[model samples]
Target: MQDNYQALKEAGAEVYSVSVDTHFVHKAWHDNSERISKLEYTMISDSNKELARELDILDESGKALRATFVLDPENVIQTVEINADGIGRKADVNINKIKAGKYIASHPGEACPAKWEEEGDDVLTPGLDLVGKL
Candidate 1:
């Protein structure tokens, strides 16, 4: 996500990485791992699992599950993606989701389709003509 952090910000979103690890561990990884070394976004340490428990992503082992939440300006959850242990998240995908969410928030009574990606993409306005067509 570090690679596309600017794209995310331009889409009207702020990026924060939350983990159950301690701040020292996070710093260690950032120092040791090449991939994490250049990250400019905030990395939150949720060692007590307070944020994890609130988000309901904590596992039985007291670890947070692999998850990403896209919240709007109001702190309303707009998208939730929970991945299996072996899965990884795509920065581009999250960027698209953020764009879709922003569009929907600005245009009331409109909904983004499953494949909506950007500002020009089509949106749905629920009405009689679109009852069962989709």
Candidate 2:
């Protein structure tokens, strides 16, 4: 996702990463890892687990589960994705979802179908006349 930070920004989304680690630990890891060092987004320290508890993503082991949230301008959560430990996330998938969300937000009543790409013609605007057509 670090590599696509600019693309996310261009799509009018700000990316932030929240972790249970302290700021010092985060800084150390950022400094040591080449990939982490390349990230230009905000890194939040949640050592107290306030965010994790608030989001209800804390596991039984007292660790935060991997999660992603997409929020609108008013801070309303538009989407939420949570994964178990050791599972990885795909940035491209999140990017496409964000794009679809934005498109739907602007063009109300329209929906994007599977594999819909930005600026593509695969969007569907449902109506009673097309109830059984799709």
lDDT of 2 by residue, 38-112 (tens): 889999999999999999999989999999999988899988989998999887677887889889988999998
Candidate 1: residue 78 Cα off by (Å):
0.8
| Overall local distance difference test of candidate 2 | 0.89
Pairing residues by index, what is the TM-score of model 2? 0.89
Segments of candidate 2 deviating more than 4 angstroms = 126-134
TM-score of each: 0.92, 0.89
lDDT string for model 1 (1-134, tens) is 88889998888888899999999999999999998889999999999999999999998988799999999898999889998788998878988898888887789999899898877888899889998899
Query: What ranges in model 1 sit over 4 Å off?
Result: none
Q: Could you tell me how far off, in angstroms, the CA of residue 68 lies in candidate 1 after the best superposition?
A: 0.7
RMSD of 1: 1.4
Candidate 2 clashes between residue pairs 3 or more apart in a chain or in different chains: none
The 10 consecutive residues of candidate 1 with the worst lDDT sum are: 83-92
